[model samples]
Target chain A: MLPVFDVVLAAAILVSAALALWVRDRIAAVSGFLVTGLLVSLSWLRLGAPDVALAEAAIGAGLTGALLLRSAHRIPCAPSKALPPSLWCAAGALAIAISGAIVWTVTSFGAAPVYPSLVADNLPESGAQNPVTAVLLNFRAWDTLLEIAVLFVALTVVIMVAPARPRTAPLGPLVQPFARVLLPLTVLIGGHLLWQGGHAPGGAFQAGAVLAGGAIALGLSGVIGSKLTRQNGLALLAIAGLAIFALAALAAEVLTGALLGYPAGEAKTWIIAIESALTLSIAATLFLLFFGPAERH
Target chain B: MSELSLLVLLPFLAATLTVAVPGRAASLGLVATAANALLVVSLCREIIARGAVEQVIGGWAAPLGITFVGDGLAAVMLAMTAIVSLAITAQAMSTPGRAGFWPLWMATLGALNGLFLSGDLFNLYVAFEILGLAAVGLTALAGTPMALRAAFDYLTAGLAGSLLILLGIALSYSVTGRVDLETVVVLTESSNGRIALALIAAGLAVKAALFPLHFWMPAAHSSAVPVASALLSALVVKGALYLALRLSIEGGAGAEFLRSALAVLGTGGMLWGAWNALRAERLKLLVAHSTVAQIGLIALAIGVAGDPLQNGLWTAAALLMLSHALAKAAMFLAVGRIAEALGHDRISGLNREELRPGAAEFAFAIAAISLVGLPPTAGFIGKWILIEGLVDEGAVHWIALLLLGTALSAAYLSRVVSRCLRGGPHVSATAQRLPWRSGDVAALGLATGALLLGLAAALPLTLLEVPFA
Candidate 1:
């Protein structure tokens, strides 16, 4: 029964991915993308990677789908030019060859769990019960720090480009009431995610996205102001993650003897502090990316 | 702080600070770049005295956490980056940029530092991501319709390149269970490993704007502001090319096939870029195209010096990169000053007597001489070493191609040089006074450095003796 479900879900995923690529209408293509995202998240769930499944569902499926839908509304859908038959045939063949090589390589990988056992061994001192969180926030915090910097750079680029300001028009009276209820719930869940990150699947990214979702809701309903403009404070908030993370990493180096090293046994406290700041910074940056430079009233 | 970490962190912190406080961004940029240059100088000194400097981030060792390694090659490249960045930063200071430019430039500096120092494949990918986005943003800062469109193409190309690199990393991890640079030897033992490496090489080639994969480079680099173009043409592209060289050296057996292929592609890029540059009407476009030609030359050097054990040949390649970075950066900054005074960069219009060519023209002449590999410049020394190596190996065909590339560089550069010196009819009664700004001084300083580097060839040669890996 489990195998059957897996096969069906995989098939659905493939179909939706193809649909996303081949669909002519923008709306339909986006719907296809959303479906594929959901199915992919479901596949993650079936693989027993609940953390990945949650991320895929929240950020990958939900936020990405929303962004796509919004973009689709702005751009007119046109029929994409079909490639020449010879080109298509060549591409197909190349894809097959590459896929075959990949499959062969994966199957022949030696019977070791690779980094997992090593990660487990070092997990205790890494300050988080959850290995993934430990890796992200402590062990390999440099990558995470740079990752947020990537986000911050993207935000900076978008602000520099200054695209058309997004409308803050309410979705009518219905959205106000809906947002009023949803906003509080989002904050609670987001905070919970941040706190739970030490021992579970939740972390700064997931929590930040949830908070951004709430901000987006308020933005859509004409509450908390609309049309994200470049405010000095907002800009500060946006870069807060990079600033705080760098300072923390440097301070750690000074206090301890190594870059990004935590003080003995007090790792959890530092990680949480960094995460909370990152949560706010990420939320602001992503929210601003979704919203254009705030409209001057 | 460990010098290795400071190499990446200092610029990153400065970039954030620049973003936070944009009021004195240009000045702050100058100060930061100066400090960063000093740091790089110290790093190079340390690498020369010692062997290499390695630091583990977050107290986690390799295969679990990233490491920063600064070796002879990394030191040379960092020094090159430092020189170019400082010159460009000084030029930018004289002519203030848009509010967004300083931070993006600083971020790019940080990213380049990270790229050169990163000892792990995945960490390099993150660095590439930051580098790519910041570079694209810088390209679009010109704010022209053409600039924006080109930036979009660059963004797409960069993303595709990064995806290929990421795919290669994934494959590598699955096979060797390590994304560290040290795993390259183990990676060469299998066909899958070879393919993975090829993918990585291809991705880096795209980012470096090697021929055929470089459709977005000319327009993007040519259309950007002068300071931005100087950085983009000189330092940003080298970041990727540096990676390609590192991979070939570390990749052991797997690199043999790729090296020959790179040589073929590189030779093609050399001639093709020269052809385009010779035909380019706009001065900036000509400079940008010349970059493609120069990159081809460096890539050819890397391809030829595929074996790390061939110390002299490999060191020659590093020297070539060093020479190109300095000369090309000086050329771009000179072009920027010219464009500013003339109010246009049309190559044909460069002869106007009303807009008399001053110190900027002198700088352009010197940079052009270096680019053409004339005597008493770093370019000549580098090319001479490369040709000598080719002679020893009896690779006469490559020798001929290298000479032909030199002649073509001379020919194309002379087009701009002669035009700058030509006398044109005084069209406007109101003489557009080409006041000497500090930007010209920066250009002259860089050009002088390139010339001095040729005379001081022993310095870099000594630094390059420390074997990579």
Candidate 2:
């Protein structure tokens, strides 16, 4: 039987998704997207995947929403361009129909999963108590490594094409003091999350995201200033995760004769070391992505 | 690291270094390109000696981890990428442009290498993202409004395509319980699997810029700077088509429908692209349109080839891709020099009587000959093999279409070829000065390679014989 809360959350998610897609005002659309992301996080929680739920709330809802809102504010809000209403309605109908078909297909075709048993079997050797963390950092480290490469590529592309960020005006006195108090606490929590990731639900990605949020908050309020955020040190930090990860892979291969093969009996040490570096890099990359390339000034 | 991993990692490492260090990008990129070419040779040699090499990343086997496969087909594609990239790198170094080109170019190379070698569906999608974003960055490097606009459109198309591909992978995983190529045969047994395969094929078609879906291609291809245009036309689009070929190989019986549809669309693209090329006002626009037609021909070959069991047909397709890459890169580089000399790229203005066509124009003519499948060129050998294979299959109508397409290519290319050879009334009696640059040398060398490949047809064909099955 379907749970009542699940049904309500799903419906709310759908409504917010529709609002995000159809709203004429850019700001309203962005808000809708944020709401949808938050609702999706709730759904993830209901599905009993707290790790995914936290990630959804932080990265998907928090970071993405902030990015969208900032961009929307930067671009002048013109009246939404209109297509023929009939055409719009047809597209809308088609989208709805396709989505309905997809949901129906998924619900109707339930199959047994193979990963759980395999993961359970390999859990002890994976160096992390949490299956998700183990899978992310040990069993499938190559994916994690390449995923960082994807982020690096994004940063490279943005650096090549994106215009310089417009000069930000100072926010009110409240924002500065709020950021000062919030910043240290955010860092502390982020570090805790990073530490907890080995045997629990929190990891580098979530921790980095939270840390990045704090950094962005400080930057946004003009308390830290763009110059500090955009320094050469920051640039190096932005790429540190990818570089370190790649080097570690090569180092592992050199020592073990297999690509990304961690040395025997030292998995936990290596995983932790890699995660620490990744945490820094991911935070820097996320911050850079939000703020654009570092300026010399 | 094994040579297989190095083939991808070296370029990635180069990309990082090239981006991290400024003003040194040119030399670093060149060294990387040269190193990469050597790596490809070693890889090809290894493949030739051994049947195929496969590696599981992080010491983890498939169904749970990614794999890299270096088969004959992949090696051939990698070789082509390396060659074209080498020429582009040489051209980029000699020509003055934005500092952003080297890192992006290297990243694209890394992505292309990854795409070719990746043995799983999900990894290929990641490679596609890198390729797509890097290509878009290259497009916008022109820094012109039109270029930026075209990049925007290309981005939209690419993202839509990526989403479709991701959805297809998800659906296929749901149906077949796995995401690797071996599971694709299993996917053919069910309706859901077929739909998933279809979605993947459709997405790849968009990226490959196949007909009807190719609306954004010409503008994006033409508006980029010369090296960017060459890479986009010669390598980026081919990456998508390569994945499609891989799909067809794995799809087994289910791919039959997709192949037939491809053939039909390919024929349409050939005729339509030719018509547009004939009418195109600018030289670069004509070249871009010709890419559309050439791609169509290659797609048609793949479609007609049908099953992977027919090695000859697939080889023909691969050869055509190789020949086209060489000829097209040469043509674009030559066009860059020609446009620079002529002060414009308008086809109508190409017959400047005040000036004699320079070595670049001569390079264009040679490249054009290859494009038209004239004698003593790689294009001719590729086409000859394709025609022979088609004839063996007793597909007469396809033969007629192929011949007609050939004639159409010749006719359109003659527009530039004739203009370059004969000076009109406006030709100045005083000899025009056209100093030879390294860029021209690189273009001519590539054109020469296209011509030489005809004489050395055994090389790539032998390399391509790594046994697909």
Candidate 3:
């Protein structure tokens, strides 16, 4: 049963990915891409990486699809041009070479480490029960800090370009009921994910993406769309995660000589506090991006 | 917090603050920049006293934790970055550019600092992402349609590079179950590890704009506002080159293939970039192209360094990078002032008879001297060490290539210097020096720093002798 499911899943992912590139219609292309992301996330789950799977589904598929859909109509599709025969041949050759090299390298590795040693041994003092959470918020929290900075950079760029306020037409009456039902469910699920992250697969990124999804849904129904411009409050919300993380890093360093090191047993408290702030910031950033361009005031 | 961490965090905090209060972005940016400069000074003194220092985040040792290493190499980069940022920030203060410039630039500084100090492979990728996105934002800050389109291309290229780097990290992890600097030594033991290094090198080449992969760079660098151009051309590209250098130092004998490939690509980029600059019609494009050529020269230096763990030749590459950052930023700022005064940046229009050589013109001339590796300048000291090393290695062919590249650089940069020397025909005997604006002063100050750095080259050379622990 597992073997059969894997084959079908792999085939579906390839088909959707091909369609994502081949489709001429923007909406269809984005949908195809989103489907591919979802399938890939399922594959990650099959590989026993539920944390990665959750992130891939939420941010990689859901948020990216919404972003593309928002900009679909504004960006006029260019006429497709076929490449010359020689160029096509070159591209094909290059592709084959790269694939061959990668396969050779992968096969030589024998087996993936899955989770390298030392991680499990050091887990007890990591402040989080879940290995993924421990790695992200403790062991290599510096990478997470830089990752937060990366998100803010994206937000700042979007604002710099200040794409038009995007006259997104309010959705039909059916959307109102959908949002009413989804919004409350979103808050519950997001809160649950944030709280469960210390010992489970749910975390700030997934929770934030889920919350952003609800916000986008409500905005589409004209519930709070126009009011959520790139105002001061929204800007504060967007930057809060990175600012909080950086300040926490400094505070941690002051308390302990090592950056991001919590005092012995207080790791969970710091992780939860930081993740809570990150969820709000991440949600705000995704929501702002979906609404299209922080219009220049 | 360790100075290494503070070097990164302070700018980040300022970036967040700047975004929060756009009206006070300039003052906040300057203050943060000054503090960052002081931090670099502190870090450098520590590195000089202590061979190299390592900070393990959260007190988690490597293989699981992220570490920041402040060796002589990282110190040199931090110091150059700090000094150059000071001038760039002062210029940005007076320029009053796009509202996002201050915040974007602050993030960029933090990212560069992080990129230089990161000892973990995955953390380097994260730093690269932050630097890449922030750079693209700076390029798009010009707000022109062309700038926006260029920024889109840059974003595409940068994301591709990041993906390649991530793939490399994943592959390396799969092979060795590790992603710290120590993995560089372990990666050399197996073919799969070699492939991982190649993949990472390929990504860095794209980010560094080495020769064939530099398609997105010229347009993006040439079209941005002056301060943005200075930061992008002088510093952002260095993040990738610095990583390549770090790999060579850590990988040692096992990474010969990557080093040689870098040298070959560096040679190609040097000539290709020079050839393009000689042909470029705009001043900014010429300066931007010069950056590509200079980066190639540094890459070539890295290629010939032969196991940096045993020899100090790679310090030549580091010196070249330091000299290039200062000189290139000065050139861009001076170019900005000249363009402002002339109302256009056309190379042909630079020799305005109505104007005599001003402070900006003099600054450009000094910067050009440094670029061409002339005497009494930082660039000359770098080239000196580079050539001396090449001679000792008895690589006659490499020496010829170096000379040719040097000549090519001089020929192209002279295109602007000659124009700046506009004299005889134009009746401007009574013309006073053009009033120095904030931009001109910044340019001249940076140019002089580069010029005087040659005399102080011993300091960085000694610092480079400090071994990484």
Looking at candidate 3 chain B, the ten consecutive residues that score lowest on lDDT are B424-433
Clash-forming residue pairs, model 1: A228-A293, A228-A294, A229-A293, A229-A294
Candidates by TM-score, descending order: 3, 1, 2
State the TM-score of the second chain for every model: 0.97, 0.97, 0.97
lDDT tens per residue, model 3, B1-469: 6787788999999999998888889999999999999999888898898689988888988867878888888999999899999999989887766778888999999999998888999999999999999999989988899899999999999999989999898889878877888888888878888899899999999999998899999999998989999999899999999999999989988889989998999999999999999999999999889888998999998998889888778888998898899999999999888777766787876665656778888999998888888888878888788788878989889889989999999999999899877744432233344465677888999999988889999998988889887
The residue-level lDDT of candidate 1 at A130 comes to 87
Stretches > 4 Å off in candidate 2: A76-82, A85-97, A104-111, A294-297, B425-434
lDDT of 1 by residue, A4-68 (tens): 99999999999999999988788999999999999999999899887788788878988888888
Query: How well does model 3 score by local distance difference test?
Result: 0.88
Interface RMSD of 1: 1.4
What digit string (tens of lDDT, one per residue) describes model 1 on residues B1-469?
Answer: 8777777787878888888888978778888898889998888888888788888888889888888888888888888988888888878888866867988998899899989998999989999999999999999998889999999999999999999999888888878888889877677778778778888888998999999798989999999988889889989999899998888788755677877877888888999999999999999999999999999988888888757654467677788888888888888888987776777778877887656678888888998888888888888888888888888889999989999999999999999999988999643344365777778888998888988899998888888787664
Which window of 10 residues has the lowest lDDT sum in candidate 3 chain A? Answer: A109-118
| Alpha-carbon deviation at A235 in model 1, angstroms | 2.1
Question: What TM-score goes with each of the models?
Answer: 0.97, 0.96, 0.97
Better of 1 and 3 by TM-score: 3
